[model samples]
Target: MASGASTKEPAAAPAATAVPDPKMPPPEKPADVRRRSYVILSFWLIVLLLGLPIWWMTTTIYRANLPLDGMIDWADGKACRPVFPLQISIQADALQPQEAQHLVRLIQHAIDDLNDFSGHHLRLQLAPKDDRRIVQKDNPELALTVRLKAGEATTASLDPHSAALDITYPSNAIPSPTSTSSPLATYIANELRSTFSEEQSIISYLLSTSSMSSDVRPQSLTPTDLAELDKRMTRSLRYAATYHLTFSLFADGSTPNTWDIEEAVEKYMRPLLDVLSPIHNFTVDTQLQLYATPGVQSQVLHKEDLASFINAAEWPLSPSIGGAPTVNFVIFAGNQTIALGDSESSAETSQSWLIPQWGTVYLLSLPDATSHVSSNILRQPMLTFGGHLLTLLGTPQAGSLPLRLSALTRIRSADLLLRSSSTLGSLARLSRSLPSISIPRTVADGVATSMYHLERACSNLGGLEGLMHARIAEEEAERAFFEKSMVGQLYFPDEHKVAVYLPLLGPVGVPLVLGLIKELKQWSKKRKEKAKEAREKKQQ
Candidate 1:
C-alpha cells in the first residue's frame, strides 16, 4: 500500500511541464523611452546650470582688486626719490649785513661744490641780525647755526650744549663784498661738511641697504665705513613710536634689593626722555627682583660671558602688553668682575655693558650687609643707561641729545619707508610665484592703506607727520603680508579639495554617467532599426 501511495505522488508531480515565464508589460514605446531620456537630460541640465554654479560661488574665496603695478613701482624705488634739503642759518652779528650776506654766498657755493650726493644737499641762510638767539627757536627747520666771532686765528668749534658752530676768525679772515672766495668761507664750508660727514655716511648706508639701485647709492662708502655702519645698525633697536623702559634691580641675595630708581630716573633720565618724546613715547616702570641667577656659571664674567649673563629664559623680561617695544635696564648686585685681559691694572673699571637692541646691565659691587641703593649710588649707572639708550635708538654718536633725537626721527622715517617698500616687493613676488595661494580682501585693503601712508610719509620725510605715516605703513604692510587666511590656504592641497567634494559629487555623477550611456544605446538602436527597414524595402 505504501509503495502504491509513493508511486501515485510521483505520478502527480508533472513530468516535462514548463512553468510560463513572467511576462514583461511589453517593450517600452519609443515615445515613452524618449520621455525618460528627456527627464534625465533635464535633471543633468539643472545640476550643470544651477547646482554647480551655486556651489562654486558659495565655496570660492573673496579677493579684492589690488594695484599690483603701482605697488611694484614703489617697491622698486621708481615712484619716488628721497631728498634731504638741510637749511643752515649763519649768524654774523660782528659784521655788516652786506658782508655777512657775501660770506654766506661764498660759503654756499663752496658747500655745493663739495657735495657729491644729490640726495642730500645743504642750503645756507643768513640769521636775523636783530635777534640771533631766536633763529633756531623761530625756524624749526634749521639744521645748524654758525656764529661768527673775531679772534687770533680762523677756528671752528661746535657748542657742547647747542647745535651752534662757533667760528673764531682773525680780523683779516672776513671776506669782502668784492671777493669771490676767502679762507674764512672755505673754512666754514669745510667745517660744516666735517660736522655732517657722519650723518651723510649714515644716510648713504641706509640708501645702499634699500632696494634702490646703485645709481642712487653713494659710492663713497669705504669698507671701514660700511663695517662701522653695519655695527651700528646691528647694535640699534628697530624703530618704534613707543618704547617701554623697564628699570629692574636684580640681586642674587635679598640684600640691596631696595633702590631709589624713581628719584634716579627723574633726576638723570628725565631730560633725555623729554628730548626723545618727539621721536618716541617712553613709559617707565620699576621693579625689584630677588634671588636672580645669571646664565653663566663662571664666578668672573668675561667680555664674551657678558652676552649670556642676562638669564633671558628665567628673567622676568617679557615685552610690555601693548604695541610698544621693551628696553630693560638691569642693575645686578653681584661681586662678578669683568677681567680686562693683559690690560694695565686699575682699581676700578667700567661696571656696565650694553646688550645690542636689548638694554644695559650694570654690575654693582655693594657691601653684602647693605640693604638699600641710594640715588647717589645710582647716578653713574643712570648716566651709563642713558648713554646706552641713545646708542640703542640709533642716535648719532657725535651730536647732543637734542640733535641726535631730531636725527633719529628722520632715520626712523627712512627705515620704515624702506621696510614697507621691501615688504610690498616681497608680497608681489610671492603672489606671482605662488599661483595656488589665495589673497584675501583684507590683504588688498592693507596694501592700499600701506601705499597711501607710504606716499604721505614720502612727501613729508623728516617731520613728525612722516614718522606717523611711516609707522602706519609698516604696520599695515606687516599685517597684509602675514594675513591668517593667506597662510591657511597652504595647508589645503588639491587632494584635500577632491576629498572634500567627492561626497556630494558621487551620487550626482553616477546618474549623469548612466543617463549618457542609456542615450548612446538608444541612438545606436535607432540607427540599426532604420538600416534594417531600408534593407527590407530593397528586398521587397
Candidate 2:
C-alpha cells in the first residue's frame, strides 16, 4: 500500500510540474515610456498639422463666384431699353424756305400726337432748297424724302424706285405763314403716318414678344395683322452671323441630275449677297442627287401637300459643320403640277413653293433625255430663290433690296439682343433654382464676357457694330449656360463622397485613435502620482 501511494504522488507531482507558473513581465523603464509617449505625440502632430490639411485640400471642390444679380437684371429686360430714331427729310423745291419750315413744324406736331410708341420717334428736317434730287444722295441715313409738286388735287404717292414720296398739291392749298392748321399739312401728316404704320406695328410686335414691360406695348394690332405677323415671325429663321446655302438638284431618275448652279448664283445672287454681306455671310454649295424620291407621291400636289413634300429623313440637309444655320434650295425635275382652284391657294399657283425658315423647291418639268442643265434654264429659278432667301432672312417685303438689307441689320440686332437677354434670365433662374450645382471659373468668366458684350450691343443698336457685338454676347451666354462641369456636379451627392472616403480613412484612423487613448491614460496616471507626492511633502 505504501509503494502504490508513493507512485501516485509522484505521478501527480509530474503532472503539476508539466505546467509551470505563468511568467510575469517586468515594469517598463522611464526612458522607454517617455520614448513611446514622444512617438505617439509626434505621429498625432504630423496627422493634425500636415496630413489633415493635405487631405482637405485634395478632397475640396472649388466654386467660383458669379454675378447673379446683374445677370438677372439683363435677363429681365430691365437693364437696357431699345430706341429707334427715324429721320425724315422734307424737300419743298416749289416753296420758300420759311414756308417749308413752318409746314414741317405743323406736321411734326401731328405726327407726335399720333405716335403711341415711345421707342420709335420721327424727326422731320427741311431739305436744302438748292437740292433738286428727291432724296439727298449724300445722306444715306434718311428714312424718307418728301417732294412737293403743284398739281390739280392734293395727292401723295410713294416713288416705286426710291424712298421718296411725291406729293402733288394745288398752289392754293399751301399753308399760310400764320395758319395753325392747313389741309395740305394735315394731308402730309396723315400720309407720313400711313407710310410708317407697318413699320410701327412690326417694331411694336418685336417689343411685345420680348421680356420688356407691357406698359409700352401697343394694342393697335388687329387680328389679321397679328396673324400675319405671327406667320412671318414663325417663318423667319433665328438670327445667325452666317448661313450655309446649299443648292441641290434632285431627280426621280438618273437624267437631269447636274445643273449650272455656280454660274447662276454668281450672276443672279452675287449682287444681293454682296449687299447683305454687312448683315450676314452666306456660303454656297451645290450637289446633284440622282434616284431621289419626294416625300409625297402625288402627281398633282395640293396646297396642303407642299408642307410635306421634302423628304427630311433621306435628304442630307444637315446644318453646316460650323455654328451657322443651313438653308437648302432644291430643284426637283418632275412632272408634278400644283392643283390650283381656291382663291386661298392662288398665292402658291406657280411651280415653286417657299418652306419657311428652310429653302424653296421648284419643280422643273424637263424631257426624259435632258441630262445636264444650262445656266439659262436656271435663270428664273435663281431669281425666285433670291426672293425666297430675302423672305427667309426676315427682310421687309415692301422695301427695295438695299433698304430691306438695312432693315434686316436692325431687326437682327434687336432679335439677338432680346434672345441673349432671355438666355441670361434662364441661366439666372436655373442657378437660383439649383443651389447645389457647382459653378466653375470658366462659367463665371463666360458670364462676365457675355454681360460686357451685351452692354456694348445695347449702346450701339441699329448699327453693324451692334450686330457683331450681339452675336458675341449670344455665343458667350450659350457657352456659360451649357457648361459641362457645372452640370456634371449636379448629379453627384454628399453620400457618394462619404462612401468613397470612409474605407481609406477608417483603416488608417483606428490605430492612431488607439495610440492616442493609451498615451492619454499614461499621462493621467503620472499627473495623479506627482500630485500625491507633492501633498505628502507639504504635510511633512
TM-score (all chains, Cα) for each model: 0.88, 0.84
| lDDT of candidate 2 over 1-540, digit per residue (tens) | 665565434344354546777898888999999999899889889999999999888866666787889888887767877665667888887888888899899889888877776666678888887654544565555677788898999988877667778999998998899988878888888887777666667667787778745234464778898889889989988888889999989899989966888899999989889978888899888888888899999877888888889987887665674878999888999998677756544544578988888889999888778998999999888999989998898887865555556566767777788788888888888888877677888888888998999999988776677779999999999898889988787778879988998999899889999999988998999999999999999999
> With candidate 2 superimposed using the best TM-score fit, by how many Å does residue 393's alpha carbon deviate from the native?
1.2
Please tell me which predicted candidate would have the highest lDDT against the true structure.
1
After superposing candidate 1 on the true structure, give the runs of residues whose Cα lies further than 4 Å from its correct spot: 1-25, 132-138, 296-299, 342-348, 502-507, 520-540
Clashes of 1: 0
Candidate 2: segments with Cα more than 4 A from true spot: 1-37, 130-140, 179-186, 212-227, 312-319, 341-348, 432-436, 513-540
Candidate 1 lDDT by residue in tens digits, 1-540: 665565434446567978999987988888998898898889878889998899889987666667878878878888666666677888888899889889999999998888877666688999887876587677775677788899999888888777778999999888878998888888898998888777778878898988754245464899999999999999999988889999999899888868899999999999989878878889999889899998876656667888789898877885874877899999988887776663435434568888898899998889868899999999999999999999999998886555566567777887888889889888888887766788998999999999999999888877678889999999999999999989787667789889988997898789788888978898898999999999999999
lDDT of 1 at 200: 75
